[model samples]
Target chain A: MLEVFGRRPYLVLLVMALLLAPVPFLQLNDYIVHVLTLFLIFAVFATGWNITLGLLGLKTLGHHAFFAIGAYASALVSHYFGVSPWITMWLGALIAAVAGIIIGFPILRIRSMPHVAIVTLAFAEIVRLVFANLKDITRGELGFWGIPPFNPIGIGDTAIRFGLGNAAGSFALAAVLFVGVHLILLLLLRGRCGLTFLAIRDAEAAAESLGVRLAAWKLFAFGISAAVVGLSGAVYAHYLMILTPTSVAGPEMLISLLAMIIVGGVGRFFGPIYGALLLTATSELLRDFGDYRMLLYGALIIVFVFIAPAGIAGLKPRLGRKPAEATKPVEAV
Target chain B: MSSTQFIELVLNGLITGSIYALVGSGIALVYGTTRVLNFAHGELMMLAGYGVLLFSVTLGWPVLLAALATILLVMLLGAIIQRVTIAPLMKREDWAFNVVAVTIGLSIFLQSAAQLIWGEQFQGVPYFFSGVAVIGDVRMPWQRIAILLVALAVMGLCALVLFRTRLGRIIRATAQDAEAALAVGIPSGLVHTAVFSISAALAGTGAILLSPLVTVSPWMGASYLLKGFAVVILGGLGSFGGAVAAGFLLGLIESFSVSFVSSEWSNVVAFVFLIAVIWVRPEGLFAGRGA
Candidate 1:
């Protein structure tokens, strides 16, 4: 298993998971736990985004749309139909996956990076506008509240309740989802599928010449990535129990995702996860700055690009051989 | 629709299209020369908006002088941003993606800074040409007409400089092949800075003209940036002239759609047209015809 999934990253994942496992039981500060929960959710998001961006070399600027789609779909369905969020979340994921394929089909066909960036960004704008304009359904930018949290699971004489001020269940759910998603990602990247993805990323022409079905693989990457993001979005909806078009679907979300990947280490296995954690903490610290928060984020991106192109993951030379491999230049498509 | 309404929409489309042309061509020029799709192009427009407001409104400068000062200031800023931010990143092997990321950061940074400094209120510039021009059944404001005319003149002058000047030759040569141009002793880096400056100037022009029609605000540039991008893709990725043509086409589509549907859906209609165009011809309408 170590050989298949690569030993070092697996070890890092295990260590991080083990370290974080006892937070809820330890009765840590609720704010700390909340931050951790937010970390896990964003980690899931950045990881899913990493599939298309880092692994597949697709510089998509609009993964936030899928996230919003997932959140809204699950929230709307659960609220309107009186169904449990547990079931609706999966339904949301399915809808987002379909949207992914629909958008990805036209998107992956283009070879120009500028065209791809513009198309994806525009598509996200369309989604945001639709959500904002559909005030009757989404409640628009006024905010969508009263969302039902996850139903508690009865365990013999005890129950794991998930609601406001008690984030233990949400943390647990997020932790499980985070671990499950990473494992799937690891498994996916360890096989022939992984090889095809690498081939396509390194050289599309060469991959196509080698009988790699580019469309199928690209769509697969996009679809799975979108589904994961969507799932996280559903988790977010139930956890936060509130939604706003700008909060979930805005371009700011894209900025956050990009900042995480770029600051952590684009294309690196453990890079974005580390990035998500660091950024979440930094954002909390900058919360007092209010308007200056995004300014600092933008400055952070530029600073990291020039000074620490290899990111935090690169700073750790003890990790393994050739730590800078992920930072290598990808061919501009 | 009535003929007068049709004429009004058409005129509105052309006027808006001219501004879009300026914005898109600026982006196209930079992309053509540098191969970097600047995410902060819109921010430059925003900066110019503030610059004009400061000069004409706060400092009490003449409108023409304020406009000139704003354009030059933005041009200088364009050069500085290229030299400081974009140039250094482009030296790296991961320049393509890094440049995109950095520009996005720069864009957000500028927007936030503007909000912090200028506040969130909308500020307007007085119209440069205030009288109305009546052509039979059509009555158009001279300000709007000036926008269309000035944009045409500016773009025409830009074309002349690009085609007829030595600087234009250097720029064109570099765009064609940077290494070849460098081999022949053309400073490609400097040319890139020049292109960025020119692009900023174009965006600045658009902002100045638009300040009266649309209030100058921090978020004002975001939507135009999106429309400019649609024009870029519809006209061809790096084709300046193509972007100009596509800009007019997009503006027309938008105005006509507003006539049919509500104004809110105009952007959707325009983007749909862009997507359809891309689906049918990924190379865009005027692609492969040279920059």
Candidate 2:
């Protein structure tokens, strides 16, 4: 597998990936870049959710709570204590990880897929409810604004010379994140835990018989996945400089995450990336279609799932058996 | 704020919860039989709401007629959905997937369709009973009282049918064990379609009965659907009795919370309880009732 994308090919793809990162730099205004930045934010969330739903064979409809937790954690730290958002982002991730781990232990022990999704969705909704109702603490629906922006090391010096503003700096920060996440994901895919995750997806009974700790790995994957999503949320809270309970744990965000994973192929390495890009971009591109946008997207997803569970990109393998093609990478847990 | 208001709150909560029970039972029945969570089930209720709004508000028909039209039309709509859309997808393990995906798609489709047909403005369905009634010193809306009574009656009929008749036996058999029901010569697939129809009909009843209290809007189903899903989870997914109890419980909680807490906090309270319950006991408050 590594030979096909040998050092030279991988280097080229990596350069291409780096080129993709500079999209906001070429953009004219902050609005476009901000939306593009949102795409990046959701990409991280979708990838995190993919770790559980796709890799672990656990269909979760909740994780919105984790996202909210991270945002709240960072927001609380920055808004109240005047801590740096970058530092608080890690704290937010930790909080969400702990919550995810706690939830995973009991819920993942149950033996049903749809039940898990239902229960998770309920949990997320409850988190949203609490956040909305806890006006004294979280500020409820009015939302929390005026969060201090992040400043990376050595970036201020570079920004002064380049004359880049907050928006541009935000884009740069997100770019680094995109690259970091991709690298980490690539490493995770090659690990033994990744293989165990895939085995669990294939057949839990068989995997259990093979000595994989059911609760342990499931909780591990859910925890790490949540931390990743939480980090994304923390960055988002600081970047947007506002945090609303609705945006954090709402229908639209949940649907976006689900749509990305579903359309991209649930268990593929690039599913979240490809899916987020397609859905986010297309949802914008076809804005003129108004409400039909979701309908069309849903239809497309249904057709894809029906004909190609591995997703449209996975269709490359069916034309001819060539070792050159990237095998449909099962997004291992 | 007062002792009178407290009693009023409890009564109001019970009334609102009655509507939830009707919707929840319908959803549970279909799920019990078909193992499909119909996302569009809420849409049917919305459509019924619009139906009554059209009949009572726009057409200026009698309230009874509007209510009847809603139930009939929505039942037909449910049957047609099953016959045309759902029945074709019933043969595979992917039956539930197609059901969920298509219903989600259809929900978006129906919401927009309503938007195009009725416009975005909120349309009120006139109260079945216009004035408030008093039992002792506590005043109540006659419509609220009527809604409670009708809701209970419909639920009672539903329970009777499920537990007392030959058709009920078939539904119970299918829900209990589809493979065994089929082996025993019961047509489980047909029963699934029928149960789905029955479920939609119940949602339609909720729409008609509750329409007077709540305004009809294109996106009304979204919020209500979340509540229905929550009640299902809280009560145990396929348990009819559980759904009824949970519906009341959620409603009562919302009512009392809204009285003591902020009105905005009521939904939050209900949802938080939902999450806590699921977090503590993933099976929900009941056992083996979920997918």
Candidate 3:
């Protein structure tokens, strides 16, 4: 069974797609739909983050800075200039990408992992502080509210509307973004640049010896990852219709993204997807635990690090026949 | 600002820097010996603060005794954390990333557990010394002076140990090269445990001193953790004396920034300074041996 599934993984993806295709139309309650929408948005974010963190092997604890920048850029642009989110979102992404390159350039020069983590974390704090202090722009702690939602497009008199005021439209938008980001990442990882990334990650000195421009590729990964995360943040801002420093760029967001990728299996193509679904579902289920929710997350990280460092994606082979053989192809994929 | 006010801020910055130096040194110690950042260092400091609250506030123990007990307890906890979580992962190919994740997990665990145990209320202890010292129109709180004195004394003691004692030599050896230390029969595992304990004890001391200055809460450690990281990086990772010097430098910068600029911008200035340092001089201003 494992062999068959492993050999025909695209079949599994197709089946999963078919299963999820009707979620918005299922007439699920608003709460469930909203939660699903959030899950999808975060899925896009975690997947994008995985490109730099998991694949490129950069340990950043401040990817939320990009996300926050994107949200703020899109919201402010729309609020002041009355630009459509359809246009402003890309602008936000471009801003975030530029910020990423600027931040990643110098820090990536240092080879130390902990140094990278500290610099990135400090960069995020600086961004958050700037946002909070710029009350005229971001409204400080008052928060930027009433962010205009994604407007509907029209064909002559008749209109095709997202109607994101409701959960269904929001869910549809999130799903499209998730699928789009996921495919881009998947294709990127399957190509030659992906091999370059793998080479840099596994052996930087060796990759550099082979004439691979280490600085350029690392910056590219960081920029692309930030752009993708920025896109998700734009969607998130529109859906929520409000943006706060803590809500958008807080340490909790970074932790959640890290937990998703770690729990799913870092470096696996579908790791963030499995991680997002399982973690989001579990957190939702354990909502009654209230204060204990974070405690559970903490425990999950510890347990996964110790018992299943490879995460859920790493568990399939252990449960299958010819476990070692089964693991090889999955890892290669 | 007047010279008196400037002097006061500079003194205050030094006091703050002393605490930061103490905390950063602990983090540096652990990192030096184990090659682990100990993301939970601030959490350990938080735990120690709670320990003081538990003993001195709840049980009404003498402040000094409570502090001594808390420091000792925290040291043991740090050693155990290293032995249990970090030591086991040392052999893994992904030790660096795994250690980071485990420490992050441990940090969250310690924070939430503190909230659970302490009921999320802000806790505090009375000033260790209640008085003020006035020198040439510059008035300073006695507590602040005591903090600086105690931190310097402890750091002096740590320096003496590291330079003058056999265990310190072993630790230094291990930090320099674990395999070489092991080949020389230094028992690198014991050195790791000792380093972690010493680091935690330093954090506890800083926490006990700081508890009187700030409202103690479960989440208080998070900011300190960041500041400690900033100090560590500015000092250059694994450089103890550099961390101490950088701590003072960062403290002065923050103090002046907060006084001249808005309070919120102080953090931004500090972080921006950190990024600037990283970009310009990754080796740190006072690059110590093996930094």
Residue A131 C-alpha lDDT in model 3: 85
> Which candidate comes out best when scored by lDDT?
1
Question: Model 3 over residues B209-230: C-alpha lDDT tens digits?
Answer: 9998896899877879999988
Worst 10 residues of 3 chain B by lDDT: B282-291
True interface contacts reproduced by each model, as a fraction?
A: 0.60, 0.33, 0.71
lDDT of 3 by residue, A1-333 (tens): 232123444654667666667997899988888888888888888888877887788888889999999999999999899999899999989999999999997777698998999999999998888888899988987899978989976679965455355777778788888777766665666677878887888789999999999999999999999999899888888889898898888877777788888898887667778888988888898888767867877888889888888788766776775556664644311
Q: For model 2, state the Cα shift of residue A135 in Å.
A: 3.4
Please identify model 1 stretches exceeding 4 Å from their true place. Answer: A1-6, A318-333
Measured against the true two-chain complex, the DockQ scores of the candidates, in the order shown, are: 0.60, 0.37, 0.65
* Tens digit of per-residue lDDT, candidate 2, span B163-235: 8899998888888889999999998778887887788878988888877677899877677787887777777
Q: For each candidate, what TM-score against the reference?
A: 0.96, 0.89, 0.96
RMSD (CA, Å), candidate 2 to true, equals 3.8
| Model 3 residue pairs with clashes | none
Instruction: Tell me the tens digit of each residue's lDDT in model 1 across A176-250.
Output: 889888988887787787778778888999999989999999999889989999999999998999999899988
Which digits, one per residue and each the tens of the lDDT, describe model 2 over residues A147-239? 777755574455411112466667667767777876786677556877888888878999999899888888999898899988888888877
Ranking 1 against 3 by DockQ, winner: 3
Report interface Cα RMSD per prediction: 2.4, 3.8, 2.3
Q: Tell me the tens digit of each residue's lDDT in model 1 across B1-291.
A: 999999999999999999999999999999989999998999999999999999998999999999999999999999999999999878777688889989999999999999999899999888888799998799999999999999999999988888889999999999999999999999999999999999999999999999988989998787789888888888888888899998888888888898788887787778777777777788888863455
